[model samples]
Target: MPFIEDFNNNHPTFIKNLLKKSPGLTQREVLLCMYLKFNYSNREICELMNISNSTVDSYRHRARKKMKLKRTDSIFSYLNQL
Candidate 1:
């Protein structure tokens, strides 16, 4: 996985605990969560992941849904709390 190595290297504990808490998350979703946890902007995420803005938005929405977050909930705050 392209981002997995960087994510694992930079945030092994967060990724591990996130998987424990939300094991249903896919690897890509975990990567999105990791970026959000770091307060990365959508533009930054898009640039780093070499994806489109819409793709980043889609990932954020999917990740939030998978995490059972409310529409108004903050993904960053939730991940930080985890």
Candidate 2:
């Protein structure tokens, strides 16, 4: 629980490093992945990113594919475990 707070606070740096390590991911994909890491819903992501819901979905889907994640896998869980 405490680490969640730390992770949330340091998320930008963490996300930056994560994106750096993920060569296949785009900036938008990294942004979406970071939001997803915090368990943000599509509506919340769209609102924060000033994007459409379908755009959010597309980014997430593409991110998942680029990361080679299974469709059933939780992106939040995967990122957190890293």
**TM per model?**
0.82, 0.75
Query: Candidate 1 residues 39-78, lDDT tens each?
Result: 8898998988889999998887888888889988878889
State the weakest 10-residue window (summed lDDT) of model 1.
1-10
Instruction: Spell out the clash pairs found in candidate 2.
Output: none
Q: Which candidate should be chosen as best, given TM-score against the real structure? A: 1
Q: Model 1, residue 22: what's the lDDT?
A: 82
lDDT of each: 0.83, 0.77
Tell me model 2's lDDT, rounded to 2 decimals: 0.77
Best-fitting candidate, measured by lDDT? 1
- Model 2 TM: 0.75
lDDT of 2 by residue, 9-80 (tens): 886466656666566898788777777777888999898889999989888888888877887987787788
Residue 80 in candidate 2, Cα distance off native in Å:
0.7
